[model samples]
Each structure stands twice: as C-alpha cells, then as structure tokens.
Target: MRLAIANLHASLGGARVLRDLTLTLEGNHFIGLIGPNGVGKTTLIRAIAGLIPFEGAITLDAAPIASIPPRTRARQIAYLAQGAESHWPLSVTRLVALGRLPHLEPFRKPQAEDEAAIARAMQLADVETMRTRDVLTLSGGERARVLLARALAVEAPLLLVDEPVAALDPYHQIGVMEGLVAYARAGRMVIAVLHDLSLAARYCDRLVMLNDGNVFADGAPADVLTPANLREVYRVNAEVTGEGRAMTVRPTGQI
Candidate 1:
C-alpha cells in the first residue's frame, strides 16, 4: 500500500489546521507522526482516512481517496481514534468484532473468516485472555489494548492510531509499542500519532515532525529528533542519545 498526499489543506470549524502539506508513505513499516498540540497530526490522519474534507489530493495506490467508496475505504484503513473510551457494557470480544463491519454484508452475522480475524487480532494484541471481560471495567491500558484489537480486527493494510500509549503505565506502553512494531513487521503499515518522543524514537522506523500545519522534518528518528528540532519545533532544550530502539530524547529545559 502506498499513500500520497499532495498540497494537502484541511480545516475544522472553519479554521484551517493543515496547509499545503505533502507526504508520501508506503507499507511494511511503522511511522510516528510527531508534533506539538493542535498542529494537524489528527487532521492529517482524518484526511487520510477520508473522515474529513481536504483541499488537496490524497491517494491510496494511486487512486484518489475521494473516489473510494466509504466501505472500501474503511476496509483499507483501520483508524483507532483518540479517546475511544466507551461507557457501554459491551464485552471486549464483541467490541473487537465491531471492526469487521466493513467486511460483512448488511444485517449479516460474523462468518468464519470474520471470527478468525477477531481472534487473531486479540491474540496479536495480547488481549485474548480478556476476551470475555467488560471493556468498561478494564484498566486504562487494558482498554487501550482492547481498542487496538478492535482496530486490528479489520485486518487493514494500513493502520492509523492516535496516542496509542496515552495515560498508560510504562509496561503497558511498551507492550502497545511492541505490538505496533510487530504488526508493521508482519507486512503491514502502521502510523501512530505520538507525544512520547522517547518511545517514538525507539519504536518508529520513520518520523514525521509537523509544526504550524507543515512538515518541519521527516526521516529516521535520530535525524528527525535532533536537539535543534527539539528546540525549534517543541521549544525545549533536549538531549538526544543512542540510536534506533535504544535512542532517547530527554528534554532538559523549555526553550
């Protein structure tokens, strides 16, 4: 799968959030979309998912996103939105099964293939043990994993997640990141909006830094998370250390 965005512009509430942004991405790797607050990371993902209107072209496999049907788009991009917390009393398995909707017929029940996908998703996310648990009763991390399972159940080639590790314990955070990496390595593409710079540096094969509606930097984590970028884009004095999964970005002071 290949995604290309050209001169992309997007707005919400009549206020533009992305401007003249362009990016190209392919499958089989994990990418981190890093940026300051309200800098259009979410907007970019929504545009790619065809959930919002954009002024430029977004194409998958060279096909315009607007030309793709809603169900077909849903089957291609599995988007796990931010703050997907649910208050309903649905079981984790049932919640995860919802991801298969795009592949099912109208008013039809899950078939063998759908069930296999749901079970594989649960296994990949390591949430199989909690399959019968109430999603609402799970801890913050557990809920996040279950939600991830739901997204994974779609078996989409491209997965987009927003803040997959927010408000989680360190252990669970690592688990989620590891799961994403594994998914990417398994011939899929994963792009996640991340605020945890260190985790982004450690886990992502590539990083795209956005600021003020444009890409400030794009490359490997080490190159993109430089002290200069940390200071300029994030306005902080940070120390960048190590390389690849061992790399760390530690902020020392506000710039």
Candidate 2:
C-alpha cells in the first residue's frame, strides 16, 4: 500500500502544528518519526489517520483518504495512540477483540479468522498471559502493551503507533521494537513516534525528522540521524556512531 501527501497543513485549537508538509509512505517498511517535543509528529499521524481536520492531499493507494468510507479507512489504518487509558473493566482479551470491529458486521460474533488475529496480536504484544485480567487493572506498562495488541489485532496494512515503548522497561522496549520491525517486514507499514533516538536508529530502517512543522530530514537512519541534523533540529551537540542497523545517537550537550 502507498500513502501520498502534499502541501499538508494541520492545526489544533487554531494553533498550526504542521505546515506545507509533503510526504509519501508505503508498506513493507518500518519508519521512525523522530524529533524534539511538540514538533508535529503526532499531528502528522493524526492527519493521516483522519482523526483531525487538515488542508492538503492525503491519499491512500492513490485514493483520497477523506473520500474513503469510515469503516473502510478503519480497516486500512490501525492507530495506537500515546498514553492510552481504559477505565472499563473489560477483560484484556475482550479489549483486544475490539480491534476486529472493522471486519465484523453489527451483532455478528467473531469468527475463526477474527479469533486468530486477536490471538496473534496478544502473543506478539506479550500480553497473552494477561488475557483474562481486567484491562483497567493492568499496570501502566501492561496497559500500553494491551493497547498495542488491540491495534495489532486490527491486521491493517498501515500501523501508526505513538510511543509504543514509552511506558515499558528496557527488555520490553526492545521486544516491542522487534515486533514492529517484524510487522513491517511481513509486508506492512509501521510508523512509530520514538523519543529514544538510539532505539529509533537501531530498529527503524527509515527515519523522518520533523522540525518547524515540516520534514527536516527523511532517509535511512544513518543519513538522517547525523550529528548536524540533531544539532539543528534538536538543538543538541550530539554524537552519532555506527552505521546502518547498528546506528546509535548520543546527545553530549545542548547546542
């Protein structure tokens, strides 16, 4: 699948978050959306997911995203928002099953295919052990993984995740990143907003850096995560080492 955007502009509460942003996203790749805080990373994905109003052309597989039916778009893009909270006392399994709503008709029970998808999503997020637990009772980290499982259960071609590893420990962070990479390798597109620059460099093949409400750099991690780019976009004197999948970024001092 392919998503093309041109001259995109988005705002929240009348404050412009993105301006004249143009980009193209496709499947079979894991992309990292990285930048300092409040740089429009979330806004860009929200616009792509059609959660907010925007001025521009955002087309999915050549068809305008706005023109697609709501249910149809729901089946195409799965979004995992940052800091997802659930107050409902539903079981983890039941919460994850909500992702299949796009596929199941009203009042129709989940079939074998839907069950399989939910199972796989739970397993990938490492939340299968807690499937019987109450979603509202899980810890912050656990809740994040459960939400991720819900998005994965959607089985959409495009996945937009906001800070998938933000609430996790180091082990789970690495594991979640690996799962995202695997999902992209499995012929899907995964765009994750990441604050850990080193992790982003290590796991994401492509990095899109946003600054001043636009894409400042877009390319392979090695090329986009350079010290100069970090200095300019992040205002930090940084060191970037290694190459390719082994790339790492370290901020030494403020610029």
Candidate 3:
C-alpha cells in the first residue's frame, strides 16, 4: 500500500498551518517528518487522519481517504498523536483493545482474534507488564508506548505517529524507533514526526523537512539533512557525520 498526499493545505482559527504540501509513502518505508516548532508537522498528520478539515487529497492504496468516514479511515490508518492524553482510568490492555473497535460489528464483543491482536501489540510495544495497570498511573514514556501499542493493535497498513518518542528516555527512545522500523520492514507504511535529527537520520528511510508551512527538503537523510539545509531552515549550524548505515548529527551553533 502507498500513502499519498497531494496539494494539501490546512488552516486552524483562520490561520493556514500547511500550504500546498505533497508527498508519497510506500509500504515498507519509514519516513521521518522534521522541522522547527510550529511548522505544521502535527497538523499534516492530523489532516491525513481526517481529524481536521483540509483542502487536499490523502490516498491510501490509491483510494482517496477524504471520501471515507473517520471510522472507515480508522480501519485503514492508525494515528498516534503527540501529547495524547487519557482522562479516563482505562486499563492498559483495555485501551489497546479499543483499536479493534473499528473492525467489530456494532455492539459486538471482542473475539479471539481481537484478544490476540491486543496481546501481540502489547508485547511488541514492551508494555505487556503494564497491561493491567491504570493508564493514568503510568510514566510518560510508558504511556507513550502504550498508546503506540493501541495504534498497532489496529493492524492498519498506514501508521502516522506525531513525536512518538518525545517524552522517552534515551534507551526507550531507541527501542520505540526500532519498533517502528521493524513495523515498516514488515510491510507497513510508518510516518513519524520527530525533533531529534540524529534519530531521524538513523532510523528513517527518507526525511521530509518542513519550514514555514511548506516542504523545505525531502529525500534521503544525507541530502535533506545537509549543513546548508539545516542552516537555512532550522537557523542553526550543524555537522552531520557517519557513513555506510551510521549517521550522527551535532548542532555546532546558532546560524
């Protein structure tokens, strides 16, 4: 499956957040979206998930996502939002199981397959130990992984995650990123918004850098994360090093 965004634009409170953005993501690809704050990365993800009204075309497997209802879209696309909050005291397992709701008949109970999916998702996210814990009682990193598990439980071919590792410790951050890489390798399209440039360079198959509501750069990490691009878009000077599957990025100074 391929996820394609064409001529996309989004506005909030009469302010345009995304302008004429377009991109394509194929299955088995891990794409990283990066930019300075307030560049519309989150808004792009939300627009693709149909959580906001936007003028554009978002297609999954060549089918226009805008033509589908939110519930229908949920079955094909899974989204893990940045700073997601759970007000209710739902158990971890129960929260993950909610991903199956889109597939169940109205008022239908969880079947054997649903239970298996939730269990698998929990195991993959390394949150099986927290399965029975109250979601509100978990740490920030734990909660983020749990929410990721919930999204995985949907088994959607297209996964959109916004700043998925923002609150994680270094170890857990790498763990979660590797998990997403594995997911993409297993024939799913994974798109993640990230602030850490090094991790994005290491784990993502491609990079899309946004600036001022437009795509500033899009291509392989080496091409998009160059010193020149970083200086121009992020207003910083940085040295990008490493070779042959290993990359390191360090900020040298303000531009």
Candidate 4:
C-alpha cells in the first residue's frame, strides 16, 4: 500500500500542531519521523490513523482515507501510540485478540483464525511468554511489547507507531525495530516516530523531520541529519559520522 499525506494540517484544543505537512510512503518502506519533543510527530501519526480530525488529504493506494469510516481505517492502519494506557486487567492474549474486532461480526466471539493471528503477533513481538499474564502486572517494556503485539494482531498494511521503543531496553529496542523491518520487507509500510537519531538513521529507509508544525527535512538519513539541520531544527550541536551504511549521530551540546 502506498500512503500519501497532502496539505495536511491539524489542531488540538485550539493549538495548531501540523501545518500543510505532506509526504509519501511507499509500501515496504520503513520511514522514520523525528524531531524535538512537541514538534507534532505524535499528532501527525494520529491524524494519519484517523484518530483525530485534520485538514487536507490522506490516501492509501490513492484511495482517500478521509472518505473511509474510522473502523474501516483502523483495519487499514494500525496504531501503537506512545504511553498508551491499558488500565483494565485484560490478559495479554485476550488484549491482543481485540485487534480482530474490526473483522468480526457484531457480538461474535473470536474464532480459530483470530487465535492464530494473536499467536503470530505474540511471536513476532517476542511477547509469547507473557501471553497469559495480566497486562497491569507487566513492566513498562513488557507492556510496550504487548501493545505492539496487539497492533500486529490487526495485520494492517500500514503501521503507525509513536515512540514504540521509548520504554524498551537496547536489546528489546533492536528486536522491535527488526520486527518492523521484517514487516516492511513483507510489503507493508511502517511509520515510526523516533527520538533516538542513531536508531532512526540505522533502521529507516527514509527520514522526515518536523519543526514548528511543518516539515523541516525529508529524505535519506544522511541528507536530513546533516550538522546544519541538527543545529537549526533541533537546536543542538551534533556530529554525524560514518560512511555508506554505517552512519551514527552524537550530540555535542544543547543550543
């Protein structure tokens, strides 16, 4: 699926968060969204997922997403939001099964296919061991993985994740990134909002940098993460190193 955002603008509680933002994500591309805190990265993800209203157009494979209902959109685009809450004591397996609701008949219970999808999602997210555990009892990282499993259970072609690795350790972070990469390799599109520049540069096929409600940079990591861009957009002194496929970022000081 090809996802495109055109002239997109969004505001929340009378505060504008996005301004004429536009981008295109071809299927099988792992695109990274990066910026300083409160730069509307999350808002962009939410708008794309149809979780919030916005101005302009979002299309999946040239089909206008705005014309689709929220439920239909949920089936097409699965979202894993940052710091998403799960207060209820739903079991991990059961929680993951919720992803199938969009495909189920009203009031119908999950079938064999749903179970298989849940299992597959758990395996993909490396959360199989926590299947029967109470979600409230899991650690932050564990819970994040479980939520990611839930999103995977949806089996959408477009995945939107907001800071999915924020609570994870280095090992789990890599694991999750690998899972997303694998998904994209399987002809899906993954858009992730990331704070860690090094990880974004390493994992993403392309990068989008937002500043003050607009796109500051959009291109390959090397082009968008230049020292000048880092200083001007992020207000930080940083060094970008590596040649070809081994690039890395190091922040020297706050500006």
Q: Which candidate is the best by lDDT?
A: 2
Q: Model 2, residue 243: what's the lDDT?
A: 77
Candidate 4 residues lying further than 4 Å off, grouped into runs, are: 243-245
Write candidate 3's Cα lDDT for 128-200 as tens digits: 9888899999998899899999998998888999999999999989888888888888888888999999999
Q: Each prediction's TM-score against the native?
A: 0.96, 0.98, 0.95, 0.94
Q: Judged by TM-score, which candidate is best?
A: 2
lDDT per residue (tens digit) for residues 1-255 in model 4: 888899999999999999998888786889999999988999999888888999999898898987887788878889998988688899999888888888788999988988888888888889988888999999989999999989989888899999989999999998998888887887788999999999999889999999998899999999999999999998999999994347889999999
The residue ranges of model 2 lying beyond 4 angstroms of the native Cα positions read none
User: TM-score: which is higher, 1 or 3?
Assistant: 1
User: Model 3: which residue pairs collide?
Assistant: none
Model 1 lDDT, residue 121, Cα: 89
Please give the TM-score that candidate 4 achieves against the real structure.
0.94
Candidate 3, poorest ten consecutive residues by summed lDDT: 242-251
Candidate 2 clashing pairs, residues 3+ apart or interchain? none
Model 3, which residues run further than 4 Å from truth? none
Expressed as tens digits, the lDDT of each residue in 1-255 for candidate 1 is: 899999999999999999999999996989999999999999999899988999989999999989989899899899999988878899999999999999999999999999999998888788999988999899988998899999999999899999988967898789889988988998889999999999999999999999999999999998899999989999999989898778988899996
Native-to-model Cα distance after best TM-score fit, residue 98 in candidate 2, in Å: 0.7
Q: Give the Å error, residue 35, model 4.
A: 0.8
Cα displacement (Å) at residue 11, model 2 = 1.4
Instruction: Give the winner by lDDT: 2 or 4.
Output: 2
Query: Each prediction's Cα lDDT score?
Result: 0.93, 0.93, 0.89, 0.90
